[model samples]
Target chain A: MTEKLNVFAVRTLTQKEYFAPGHRACQGCAEALAVRLVAKALGRNVIIASATGCMEVVSSPIPFTAWRVPWFHVAFENAAAVASGIESGLKVLMRKGRLPRKKIVTIALAGDGGTADIGLQALSGALERGHDFIYICTDNEAYMNTGIQRSSSTPFGASTTTSPAGKVKMGQITWKKNMPAIAAAHNIPYVATACPSYPIDLVEKVKKAASIEGPAYLHILSVCPTGWRSAPELSIKLGRLAVETGIFPLYEVEHGKYHLSIDFPRLRPIKEYIRLQGRFRHLTEEMIGQIEERVRKEYAELKEKAAKGVAR
Target chain B: MGKRVGMEVSIAAAEAVKQANVDVISAYPITPQTHVVEHLSELVANGELDAEFFCVESEHSALSVCVGSEATGARSFTCTSSQGLALMSEITYIASALRLPIVMIIANRALSAPISIWNDHSDVMSIRDCGWIQFFAENGQDVYDHVFIAYRLAEDRNVLLPAIINMDGFTLSHVIEPIEFIEQEKIDRFLPPYQPVHRLHPDRPVSMGGIALPPIFTETKKAHEVALQGSMPKILETWKAFGDMTGRYYQPVETYKAEDAETIMVIMGSFGETASAAVDLMREEGRSVGLAKIRLWRPFPFEAFKQATLHAKQLVVIDRAISIGGPGGPVASEVKAALYGEPIRPVVYNFVAGLGGRDVSPSDFIKMVDKAEIEIEEGNREGYEIYGVRE
Candidate 1:
């Protein structure tokens, strides 16, 4: 079950910022805001093992850091593996009486490129081993840090630097990799999808994930304004449009049971979401129709799963 | 003193890790390196070693886990052979730079294009510049003893760097040998609980492995180089204290009957023992030949190495790994570089031998020396020959 939060409830939330300000993030980077919300949920009693990506580079420069909690950044593609190690190390140390037995939540943060592509193996390994940690994948569709290169999580019709729109070819021709489905398939204790546009919901989901035992995966749809070639001011509006258009749904899967965070009797048109971003500027009406068809089918399937409820 | 027991060297290496009281052992199984992790898992399973041992997905994740755990102020360890080492080599450099002080045991094996799971120096040679404190073990006993010494040296506040103990695959790992382990009390005294210089704790809240810009990159590297080179004194001090407790002394460059010899052979890893025997055999025949075994490979004992072989006229450097089109062999290149400016230095000759688990016995070492001598007489000085290769 998910709690309904109003603007009044958001005002009551803690004003303390664990992810400090004065770091090098873009003007309207929703991923950075998502990180701040996640950090707020985790508070000071957490250790983060971050993969080399946008947030890692933006937050941690030598001798400077945005993290108020203990954080570690290893090479690309091993955030889950590193988090597994941190969890096991802390567990063993506490058990051996070398450290005080306190609840220290271990979290692994990675971008979509780090999570869906290079880091997939390490993530699967850590999930299979069932380490007590939270894995948060901030999905911005492409490798935005490397100048908008195409990633596996890049949507089928979105144009990137690597998947350039040209005379003979169009944008990314592959469907976005369903990372939440993969995480839920691991039979993990909790798997949720959130967005920074819904700040309270994102924070609540992260808090729930941190409270659960064993492994939890959170896939947050992080909107990149610079990479998407959209106006920086429309970053939150774009995220909301993505969810309302059913291109990126907000839901949670707990123990094989799915719960849709927001239900719509009628979904918004794909043009309202796609026309605002430069990445989809090259798409024709026919291509937009095709994308809309697929989005409708996928959204219907997700709704079916949520209705099935306790089927698993 | 503890009881001397005949055990498989890999198992003994695991026992040494157990005695060191490591907090985490994360490894992936590879040939010749499997038994070490297998025994460690067994120790953890049976409640003999109170450690967290995980068989991770790959060697990359294995070393990544060690780096994470070590950064968390836990004594972490992992072992791998050639392919596994190559897979994890990227993280090895990071671990040392972060100064995690994780101890690793590399079972030396040949790299694969032909894909052979056999003993050679190719694995360790590939990571020559990884910046870890690297050394070779001459035999099973040496491998067993260095585990404690590595932990002591790596965990020292003055020498907070990771270390690698290389032992010949199958030659030292699979064979049973008598190892005399130190008493538990002595080991505890020698290697105290690891006190990390920086750790990821909520109480401390430090950031590790941050990206260094160009302005600060060179300074960080300079500091790392200084830290590695500065660890030599602590390494010597640790060995001296261990020798006082166990009565078996160790050194950077160990020599065998090289004090008055004109011709000396140089080698590393398990071949040192066989080369020593070959030197003795040659000496009995009234020939002037000796052996200089290089124990320390990184922060390479330049002074001790020059002291050992500068007097000899001809130095036969036997390398187990080929450099492939660049130089003759990696070790021979280092030897040449170490002796380049010396006024009294040997005319170094190199031979690549014992490749892909091929047997190079005492006679084989003697034959290599004989070949080097004849080639020197024939004025063939610059190039190296892959010994035992068919035309």
Candidate 2:
């Protein structure tokens, strides 16, 4: 049941990039990095239906765009639903010989708020309907575009504008939504959790998901330094720390089988991941111990599930 | 002209979608509208219509799917009823704002408070300003014909906006009627292939539905308004072309014996038929009563409506939906606003009738007209009256 990471190789990217530069994303936005990798992975013959959130606003401003591919931004909660339409439309055209391309890769990209909170119903519907598209959730924990409000994906005890740390109440009181598990419950063909710090893993997962015939879900832990109250330069560091500490594991569920893609032999304490972020500044030693216990319990459960290879 | 066949209204509507050769249909079933999508699904399933049929999870996703496919230059379609349309309300606005040119058929039904499952105009009124070109179909013939008209006008490069064809729930939807079914070749010649001026294609990349900030927000809205108002000519031209081919003509306003009448009744949707019958009875009695049916709801048909009511001294406006605490019903308010500054204005009487499937027969229409005349003379026509209300 143990899994090991592949040895580091020379990082080379595809020559053709669909996501161009000059996007209005922040200096060290990990979501932007993930999108760049995803665009490269899904090189050509792709259409992206994005939701109304940071990625969409940053990529497409009023008369300018950073996308070199055909892109659409619908309402906040219907990215997956919109992509379902695109997939169906393309299929019809291809079948009728109206379109020159025999196949097109359709992807929907959304932020944590657009994926886990407001947009979850549409995502669930799209997955249940088995649309031939890949939905990528760029989880930044909070609604960063709206000035750091807490989303359902915001981890327990992380301070957001809406979940600010105060004298009586701790930061966030709820656990991060388990989106991959929810997607797994739909019994889609592919479900994976990825991190931007691991470009090779993220890109590979995107490519794999694009090749999937049925619905595929990819949850990427996109680090947001501004929302997390950490140094912008620590975006990549935080992404790596998140996966390394078992707070966010990199794994895939294909059909009904679970396989760990990036398994840590030994996990660091929860503080190793939270200490660099000011959002966790109010955590006492007792609180940190509690968080550690919770993380260990959840990691142990995920590990057991991966080992048992249970569909459910 | 094509052969006439006896078919259920819903099936005929589905046949129109088939003849249009739409590329995609995404729908979630609601009563009255279900038969339309159910038949469409069969057509797609049997390869009769080469289209993608998506049984979407909700009406929200149904219209959202249409927007997605329409942006890809596909002629997309979807149908819904009262609560279903309410569920799809948000995306309905986006479809028009994005200029997707989708054709949607709304089997008009009563909105829920008591949860009635019959016909009314509440569903259509709920989306009155969603920016889509809207039409009311009075019978099975209009439902079948308006489908083609909806597509033609909506897809015109000058129009490039979504359109809605509304038929009364269960009344026009479930009733079986003999309709002149047009051939596929004729439909092809009329509709042609939908060639979007701009669409989602990798060869020519375009960004759709971008955010409009403070500087350009009002300007964007202005552009949408101008586009809709500008679509009037194209709507007329498309109807004219269809009429030339089939001898079945349509206009923004159609009058029934209103040419030389002193009193007129204004109604939309299927109730127009009942009002026409009532007008015939009144005319036989040597009374100067007539009916003016409003087919086009958007673009207002200002000149046409004004011309239709200008000669009449008393005009009765029937509305099926209330604006709820506003002055009178939605239709009556619009009519009063339309006639406010005119030099020759009629004494308008607002009447709310046939709500939530309460049948307003021809006799009831006659009574309604009689009551409006009394109210006008008594100067009690300042507000609206709920026709047939016990109190």
Candidate 3:
């Protein structure tokens, strides 16, 4: 089933900036774009806990930081854990009449490797504890900060520094871990997947996640031109392709009920998304067929689950 | 004065945090340390204390969250034991390096391979160089008093460093003792509000825990070192203020009957009480023995240590943990280093004892001192001995 693309109701973003300029991110960085939009949605009444990744490294370089909002840079594997403390800390302050504001949003920003691999246990723990915070995983497929190493979030058939297409091996041999599904299994109030290509969709998901009472996890598919071996200017285009080709579906799960946000009834071929990226150029026809088959099967499963209505 | 009541040392530690008006307590449950957090959780739940009690999943997250909350300008506390403290070792350095004033209570337990959940100094000694100002508590009163003392020293703007209060596991944590609970009003006047100079506020943003390149890494380390070393004055000043308020004095290096004694026994943690008892027995027997207890381990109190031991001819240093194939015990090694350049110092002898929950009584301490005195008189001072070990 498909829903109408309501672009008219989605208002244009405000001029105020929280993720200020002068960050050392690569040009046309999709993750940077997502962070800007995410910050805009969160507004100023928030504290951010960022794990050691591209976003953290670029935004903060000692004595000079791009973050205008209150931000903390903890270790790589404990962004969610840190956010839990921030939320609880603020709650205690408010209850004790120490803080003037009764409430403040607590958010965590982590990279693919931080969310899917090193930080998975912390993420799981925060969600299970039902802390009032939003955990955003800006998935750039691989560890873009550490020279394009393969992470669990790296999709199958994508070549990375650790998962190179050598003489015997083609590329990455395993499928990308379903991080959103793992988050949903925590039974948190909200879990969603978004793309930075559609700024309004991404911002809307973030705002919705922030409004939820308990923990909300938002997984954003951020494109990495340098890691993906694509043109830097084509970052937005690649992000759109990831969604349009059914490679990274745009959907939200509320109270364990799945709802598609951007449903492309007639999906574009995966080749359109893979051909431009040099990381996937080493793929053979047989391997492409296998990937395609796997994508279709997963998409079918998602549709069936979404159509099943609210989980009981 | 609030009240004088007999309370479990762990519960007294929790009450001390309550008196400090801590804003957040993020802890993972571990044996011996569990009772402290349990009482804290009860206080938060019962509305007796208005604070956040986070049942963090692991010790790593417990300390990680404390770092997060403390950076946000909140008074935070946490507690852990052997494996829990070991699990939190990585973030322990981060908490200090970032200069987050989060106070933690470590109910000391032995690190395992034999897997014993008993009282020992191994856990505290394992992370000796983590850069936190560590204190050893001899009893329930010290545990209660130092909780307030640690927060005051840690939260000082000049010394924005994390602190650890170590109490012997099962021995002090499980033992009930009569303690004077200070009034909250007095604590408020003494501690004042923790006004964070640099905090994570959206209105006034400041970046913490930033990456320091090699060019500035050395400077950052120097700053941290200077800050730690410079904290000694503030530590003494804080103890003076606390002592004035409560009439219970504390010092970096405390002594008992050591003014004219030829031989002095040095110890830490709960064993300090036992060592003092042994010193009294030795004095009764006219053996000219005394006791010196190290309360402040970090900022190592080198001046105080030197001053305390200069008059003694010999020192029987008791260590509950071994350095394992390197030198002697950790405390013994630090003690030797502290005394190396001194013109007049004791012929220090190390005795590793009371490990893995093994009880070291007052009689045992007396016997160890006797052995050490005999060794020194016979000019047989060589390697350190494992006191009371079944050889």
Candidate 4:
């Protein structure tokens, strides 16, 4: 099934603007694409906590702001904590004063490195603390800003600067840490994964997450052209390939059950997804088979769980 | 007029919050601090204190609940120590930044690693720049007196900053001491019910925390700075009013025998009592030594600090914390800077002591003063130095 993105499908943005063009993001960055879509759904009167990462630094250049809404930039791992603070602060201010009483919502934005790595403990603490905030992770896999380094979210068999795919070593031997699964394990209200290519789905998930009280996690598969060694235009194409291969499934964990949101009629070969990105250029046929087998095993387990649906 | 009853300091603090007539008490129990909140909860349960008692799941929630209650125009409080304060720190900073006027009792304890439940300034020190008006009480009764004043200090329309009453964990919190309870009627006469300058009512609207751009951010910070600076005189006035009613005088920087002293030591929080006894012991030994206790850490009392140490030939600033690679404890550094342009600034030397509640003996205070004098006379002038360490 040759599923190239159809250009005829045009998605027009409304007059709503939460995140504006002044944000500091690399050209053709998928995270930027995801932010624009997510913000459009969140609407105004929204407050954001952008954790210290490439997005925060580039968008908020000192005095100037890329966000049209009220935003805060705290340390890398405490976006959730900062948002929690603002939420609570608003409650107090509103209770004793008139400010922060309107139809305001709080959201936390973090990079994959911040969410899956350094900020995990704080995130867990905030969720346990029962803070009403939405946590969004733009998972670009590698730490692209501080020079591309391997992160827990980096996929297996991907070549990072640290995990170079060499003649002797091959590529990344470890699998990506199941962050959405971990977030769901918190028993939070909602947890879902989306791809930048599917902006409507991503925005819809964000709106759903925001509408719910308590903690919610939305993981967006943001492809990095520089890190993935793919053409800028191929970022969205690679994102689609990831979903088609069942390598990065589009699903949501609600309450305690799993529901697969997307289903391909037939699985696309792993070589097609691998061949498009330079990170997977060094995979040998044997390596490819091993990856394929692992992906199949993971998919089987996910399907079994999804089939079970809310089992204790 | 008074009765000497052996009362635990935590109970003393709990009684003080009771006297302050706090409308809501929301807190999670932690070491050394549990007793205070437990007492408050018991008071609430028994109907002795007609207030909301929230047993929050975590310290962060505890503070958040207090913030919520305070915004709703209720006099709110919470108690915690060590990791609890660290957990509340993110919101702790926000509470002050938004000027919630919420008061908290922090039974100060050491931070984790070895995971000590013991007394230390580490946890309180970690949140030094959190914007809360911090105070250190030297004893159980001081804990009682300070809490009454703390509510007044924090709730002042000009101040509008959250206040933290820092007392030693277990050391003072669990220890029993004689405390003369201020009658509830008397407290009522002293503290008016919290009438906030603003409220979260639909009838009126105001922005508490909004998007602050560099151009507009300056105004937000300027407003905060003005409030902090403005709170100084209001705090003094309120303390004076409380002093007139209760016959207890309060100073941002309290002086103990610094008039004709050749040497002086600056200390803060509950450790001031131990330091005071040391100063008395040193003076008995024919040493011209004095002590300065900083009750209000936020306002810094720069002018008062400068004036109190103006006559002293040498100054020993004791820091109960370590700044690691930077300028030692945050206290001594600020003190040194506060005196930088003083016409008669004393020879300021830093001394780090009583960390993790390591005993701060009177002899150590004497030794610190003598060493500072030597550094002063020798003219090997430096901005700051430390005390009570292994040679």
Candidate 5:
């Protein structure tokens, strides 16, 4: 699927945007862009169950909705459970001859807090139940929808409202949860990590997820300029820097086989990514060195996993 | 007429759901509520009922699954009790707000503190204001019958809201009684396949459960209130239709020997039968006593309740659940509010009895009336009494 597309392959992607314009997202909100690319990949034959978060609040404000496809937003933590229901409902209806037996992908959308924090149990339940669905976790590190509070997905040393860098304490005290590893541990068919900055890679991954048989999980690192306290124009660049710095790697795990989406000959320095974001402004050189050591170790581990390329 | 079989109330309720041809059944097992979902799974497993039945991880997910399936245009059903209801109470409100028309059976039990899993109204009373159409069942038959009624009424175009059928936990749900099942062909004609007002479909796209801002929040609430209150006529119509088919009539506020009576006992749930027996025994003694059993709990049948109890000189309201400190009992408060400021209203007396499966027998009902009459004579009617208390 990747071989057919050229370097500037985003132009070859379908122009029909299932996620319409006129949404209420802030400028340079890459979460909204990630949603658009996901919508574009899945196209019209899909039903979306979105959790109550930034994208849901922005796109669906009562009488006006930016979703051109069938969409539902039930609550904050049950997007995966709702998607399970939708998948089962469509199957039973089709089997009972009440609905036409055509393929309609069921997709669940949620933000970082909604997925890694509140929605984790429900997502695990749905995946274990083996529902035919795609779960896209649009992670912006913090709970950006609700005033940038710290979430389980929030990285260490990143200042949030709840985990402020005060006189005694610095930023978030905990490491970001490895949601993709947890998802892959469920033995689901497909698990991937993508960013909106690489539109073609993200689109290909989404398409691949939609094609899979059972549960597929995509952990998208959606850059939130408002929450990160970064310049709006740096949203796309920050996403790229995140990938280049080996902070947020681009990879996929298919049937337990590890594959790196983009491999770097030499990773960029972590300072390039941290310096661009105000959330990490308080971090000293020593703190940066500590973060750099952890990132390097984790990136090496990921490279080793890819090198093995063995299905568990 | 269908066959009359002796079956446990929970099993019969599951049979009723099967007859309704529900497309989905998602529920988590709680005590007393377990039998209903267990039977449903068995039916689905045996191919007797072609429905999607699964036990979700938690009661919250159980109702969430129902909300999802129902919103996708599938007729959905679920059952729970006590803590399960409390766990899923959040989604119950969302389900009604979304107008999904899912049907649920609540095997009513006492809420925690001591964590007693027994018959009481505490579970149902906790969610009294959840915006779903609620009713109580007196026995196994009523529990079985209300399954069809709830689905029919809930799925109606004019009343696209969820409905709850509450039956006492062990007293009703676990007891075996002879239930006359309605014929499938008759149920087919009475309750047709659900046609959702709006659904998740690829061919015709629509978004549901959107965020309502301050600008239109009040209007949405008003519309929901109007829709719930407006469902009265359809509730009666559906009951009348079911009665016409089954030869068993039902009403929101059913009365027994209340005409020309000076004292009437107002009650709800399975204990209504015992209260009726007490009324019969009291009538044999030539006392002016009667019973008014309230079946429909939500959109309270104020007119019928008023008509039944207003003519009486004294009214005794039996509540199985207490309202903590504010009011003695929640039902008594509602009853008082319903008859407040009326020109010719009865003096209301409230008794909170049968807490946590302590049986309220026919004699207990008689004792309540006896105590109420004495208390009324002594002019001590400002608050309520917890009847049969040791203190």
Candidate 6:
């Protein structure tokens, strides 16, 4: 399978100049990487509606612009809604013979704060409408854009501003919100979870999403070195470890079937995952054991769902 | 296209959108604005109009879909009222800033709390500064006509903006009136299909809605404002073209029976006829009163307001919505602001009346006209009276 996949990769051509390399993304910023991959997959015919957060502030700082493709950054909460309006606006303009060029795609980009918190209603409504668009949530676990504050997407045993580690507590009390699962319940054409270390896989998933007829969601786990207090170079190693340790599983939902995209034969222990990240530095052996137990149980459930896919 | 004669207001609005030739319409049923989108959806479904209609999840998506459609450089149209319009509040600002040329119909209705679904100007007035060109219609005919004109104004090269055509909710949205429709071919001649200067297309790429820095951000906003103020000439020109094509004239401020009247009643939206009837009735009773209907609320016709109120001694400004804690009603306050230092202006009296579509009877109009005169005589012109408020 590996030999067949990368064998013809030389012939693969990408769409040109949408989100260019000049963007002000920090090194090892998973969110920016996801954006870069998505842009390549979407081609030059794409337009983006991004919420105001880390990526937007850094990339678009005034007279400077990073996008070769058309990009619109509305408020933090209404990126989805703004993307919806853009989608509708383009359709109408095309119908009236006003559109200069034929091919155009609109997408909304948001951070965990923008998507899981204030923007959830707009996100949910946009998906429910079945609009022909994609919404990508660059989940950095916490609201790193706003100073490492806690967000709903923040996972268990993680130390954030609002979920700081203390004498009586471990780290965060709650587990990460099942955003992809919730989106899956919408019964949209497509829903997937991805991380940036695997660029080609991310691109493939995005291509699959774009081919779908209606709303498709892609939740990307963006690593935040500043927020997670992890080493910059450790980002990829940490991202890979997350999947290997079963902390964050990569999966996709189609029609009604769930399929695991990245599988680990023998999962690594949870202690190895947390010891490198400063956010979970305070975790003890017992806490790691508990996290491991929860991860194993969740992985088992996901495996069962993947097993049920053929019947569906 | 030829002129259509004597049709329902809602039907006329649907006809205008059909004439506007929108490509995608996102709609959900809301009272007063329902028929407009309902009819547009039918046209799209039946191939009467070649279009895509998205029966959206909610008003939020309705506006979102409109934004997406506009950003893609497509001519999109939608109609919503009250709660629906309120729900779309966030996107309304984005639509204008993106300069998508989105045309929307806001059937004026009172927002709920008391939960009434009646005709009123409250909803439209609440979003007064939403960055879209706001227009008011006195009856169904205006709703039908202005929608076509709105598309022309919004899609203009200079004024690439969004516009809202507000007709009185139940009163104008549901009321069938003699509305003259223009032929589609005629509309095509008068208002050409939207020609966007900047399209979000791959061939000749451009960036839209970028984060404008301090150096350029102010200029971006200034561009919108300058376009808004400068759009007056084109707005008048569009109206002239429409009038020339259909023989039905329209103006920002329309005056009637005010040539030599002592008292003038200023109002907006669907209640113009109600004010007109009182003007006629009061004149017979020797009250020397007339009426002035303001059609364009934004890019407000200051010259027209100045001309229409030039001869009046007392002006009764009736507003259907209240602007609590700041001024009386926003319309009354705005009127006062417009006439702040005009040398020969009449003494203005603001009246909050006909809220949430409670009846604005001709009897009440006459009483308001009389009350304005009494307030003028008493030298009391600073405050407002909630008209028909019960003890």
Counted clashes in each candidate structure: 0, 0, 0, 19, 0, 34
Instruction: Estimate, for each residue in A262-312, the C-alpha lDDT of model 6 and write its tens digit.
Output: 888779988887898999998888888888999999998888898898313
Model 2 Cα shift for residue A237 (angstroms): 0.6
> Considering every candidate listed, which one attains the maximal lDDT?
1
Model 2: chain B TM-score vs. truth?
Answer: 0.98
Sliding window of 10 residues with minimal summed lDDT for model 6 chain A: A1-10
* Local accuracy of candidate 6 as per-residue lDDT tens digits, B1-391: 4544766688788988888777778877888788888788788878899776777667876877777667666778889999998888877887887787888998888888888798777787777777888899888777877878898888988888899988788788887787766666777876666667876666766666666667787888887788788888988998998888788789989988987888888999877898898888888888788888999998888888988887788788999898778678888888888888788788889899988888998999988877778777888977588999888
The CA lDDT at B51 in model 2 is 91
Docking quality of model 6: it rates as medium
lDDT of 3 at B15: 90
Model 4 residue B196 CA deviation in Å: 10
What are the iRMS values of all candidates?
0.7, 1.0, 1.2, 6.8, 0.7, 2.8
Compare candidates 2 and 5 on DockQ and give the better one.
5
Runs in model 2 lying further than 4 Å from the true structure: A1-10
TM-score of every candidate relative to the true structure: 0.98, 0.97, 0.96, 0.76, 0.98, 0.93
Kindly list the per-residue Cα lDDT of model 4 for residues B1-391, writing each as its tens digit.
Answer: 4345789989888888887877777787898898998889888799788765666557876776576456546788889999999987878877787788888888988898778888878899899878778788878877898887888878877788988888888878988888877777778877778878864433342333333456666777777777777788887888898788677778889989988887888888766888889989988889898888888888678988887888887778888777878876778888889988877778778878887778877788877777777776788666465556669
lDDT of 5 by residue, B1-391 (tens): 8899999999999999999999998888899799999999999999999998878888888988998899888999999999999998888889999998999999999999898999889998988988999999999999999999999999999999999999999999999999998889999999899988888999999999899999999999999999999999999999999899999899999999998888899889998889999999999999999999999999899888888788898989999999897777888999999999798788889999999999999999999999999999899865488999885
| Count of backbone collisions within predicted model 2 | 0
- Real contacts recovered, all predictions: 0.75, 0.74, 0.69, 0.02, 0.71, 0.68
Instruction: Assess candidate 3 and give its TM-score to the true structure.
Output: 0.96
**Order of models, best DockQ first:** 1, 5, 2, 3, 6, 4
Find the 10 residues in a row with the least total lDDT in model 6 chain B. B200-209
Candidate 5 DockQ vs. native: 0.81
Summarize candidate 4's per-residue lDDT along A156-213 as a digit string, tens digits: 8899999898878776778898889889888998999999788767766777788788
DockQ for all candidate structures vs. native: 0.83, 0.75, 0.69, 0.07, 0.81, 0.57
Candidate 3 lDDT over B1-391, as tens digits, reads 6689999999999999998989989999889898999999999899898877889889999999898888877899999999999988989989999999999999999999888899888998889989999999999999999988898899898999999999999999999999999988888888876888887767676777778777888998898899999999999999999989988989999999988889989899999888888988889999999888999999899999988888899988999999888877888888899999988778999999999899999999999988998898899664498888786
Query: Which TM-score value belongs to model 4?
Result: 0.76
Stretches off by above 4 angstroms in model 5 are: A1-8
Q: Scoring only chain A, what TM-score does candidate 2 earn? A: 0.95
In candidate 3, list every pair of residues with a backbone clash.
none
